[model samples]
Target chain A: EPEVTQTPSHQVTQMGQEVILRCVPISNHLYFYWYRQILGQKVEFLVSFYNNEISEKSEIFDDQFSVERPDGSNFTLKIRSTKLEDSAMYFCASSDQYNQPQHFGDGTRLSIL
Target chain B: EDKVVQSPLSLVVHEGDTVTLNCSYEVTNFRSLLWYKQEKKAPTFLFMLTSSGIEKKSGRLSSILDKKELFSILNITATQTGDSAVYLCAVYISSGSARQLTFGSGTQLTVLP
Candidate 1:
């Protein structure tokens, strides 16, 4: 089965540094999303992208967060001035159309110290 | 805010046993409900339930959605050690031509031999 894939399985960063998490969604997918799971917490939706624009975002996706689809397949999330609370597993997901089951990537573990 | 609630945050079952995981949601204009299995890194897609009373099944796993009651259940029969993982339930809701997901805290299932 074709699956979503994320780069740099793990990332270690210091507070106030910048980080970029990359994902290559399934080739034919049209909608992309980013979610985060804090240790011992529920997975929370961060943002969803479609047609090169952010369609929806949560409070956690504040000023410091940005997402880009630089190319056909590459979707990335950048975090500027990371805080200690930013440490969590960031997941990328994609779906072919609306109301479809989304496919998820093996998450990128972001660790901020 | 859309909310998803999963009951019995953890479960333990012996090999060949059966288990059921529950999920309930409160949202507007529900689109679909999904079940995923998370081992350590990624949450693999399991099933998607859209219409109520219609069951979706794969091998030993089955899921059904109850729109009238705003709930769903995932059943695993003859569980194996490999089934030890966190089972996540998520709901997709449509909002003025946009849709987003809300996830519940997963149920950690440990199927021992």
Candidate 2:
């Protein structure tokens, strides 16, 4: 079965540096989403992208976060300035339709120090 | 505020035992309920139910949604050690042309030999 895939399975970055987490959604998917989970915490929604624009975002998705669909299959989340609290497992998910089940990537573990 | 609550945060069982995980949600617009299995990385989709009282099943796992009560349950029978993982329940909210998902803290299931 086709699945969402993310690059840089794990990343370590300085506290003030910028980080980009990349994802290649399923080829035919139309909606993409980003979610994060702090260690031992519930997964939280960050943002959703469709038609090259952000469709929805959570309060946690503040000024530092941005999402881009630079290409047909690539969906990326960029954090302008990382904070220690930003360290978490970032996941990418995609769905073919609005209300369908989303398929998720293995996730990129972001570690800030 | 939208919320998903899962009961009995952690469970331990032996192989061949059966287990049930519960999830309840309070949201503005309910679209669907989903179940996922997480083991060390991203969550893998297991089931999605849109209508109430209709059960969806795959292998030894089955789920049913109760729209009237705003709850759902996931059952696993004859479990194996490989079944040890965090089971997450998420609800999709639809409003106008937009949709978002809220996830629960998840139930951690440990199946021992």
Candidate 3:
């Protein structure tokens, strides 16, 4: 079974530094999404992308956060300035169509120092 | 705000025992519900439920949605140690041209050998 893959399983960065999390969604999947899970909190949606543009984003996806599909296979989430609160497991997910089940990647654990 | 709530945050059972996890939600323009199993890194897809009454099953795990009552249940029978994991429930809601998932806190299941 084809699956979504994320790079840098664990990332550690300084508080004021920039960080970029990368994901390669299933080859044929169209819709892509980004979510985060704080250590003991529920997984929270960050943004959704389709047709090469951001379809929707949560309040947590503020000025510091941005997503880009730089190429056909890579989806990247960039945080301009990291903070302690930004430390979490960032997950990438994709679905083939609308209302379909979105498959998740193993996740990138971001740790801010 | 759209919310998904799961009951029994934690559970422990011996092998061969049966267990059921509950999820309830309150949201507008409900699209679908999904169940996932999280062991350590990622959440693996389990099932997706859209209509009520009809059950989606795989092996010893089964799930059903109750659209009218706004709840869903996942059942695992004759469980094994491998079945131990955090079960997450999420609801999809239509948001303009996009949709996002709202996840529950998840139920942690521990199956003892």
Against the native complex, each candidate's DockQ, computed on alpha carbons, is 0.84, 0.82, 0.89
Give the clashing residue pairs of candidate 1, or none. none
Write down the lDDT of every candidate, Cα atoms only: 0.94, 0.93, 0.96
Q: Which residue runs of candidate 1 sit more than 4 Å off their true CA positions?
A: none
Task: Output the lDDT of residue B81, model 2.
Answer: 98
User: In candidate 2, which residue ranges exceed 4 Å CA deviation?
Assistant: none
Each candidate structure's TM-score, on Cα atoms with residue i matched to residue i, is 0.98, 0.98, 0.99
Total backbone clashes of candidate 2, pairs 3 or more residues apart or in separate chains? 0
Q: Candidate 2 residues A6-45, lDDT tens each?
A: 9999999999999999999999999999999999899999
Question: Candidate 3, residues B31-76: lDDT per residue as tens digits?
Answer: 9999999999889999989899999999999999999899999999
Q: Which ten residues in a row have the lowest lDDT in candidate 2 chain A?
A: A66-75
Q: Point to the candidate with the largest TM-score.
A: 3
Q: Model 3, residue B57: displacement in angstroms?
A: 1.0
lDDT per residue as tens, model 2, B51-108: 9999999999999999999999999999999999999999998766657779999999
Which candidate leads in lDDT?
Answer: 3
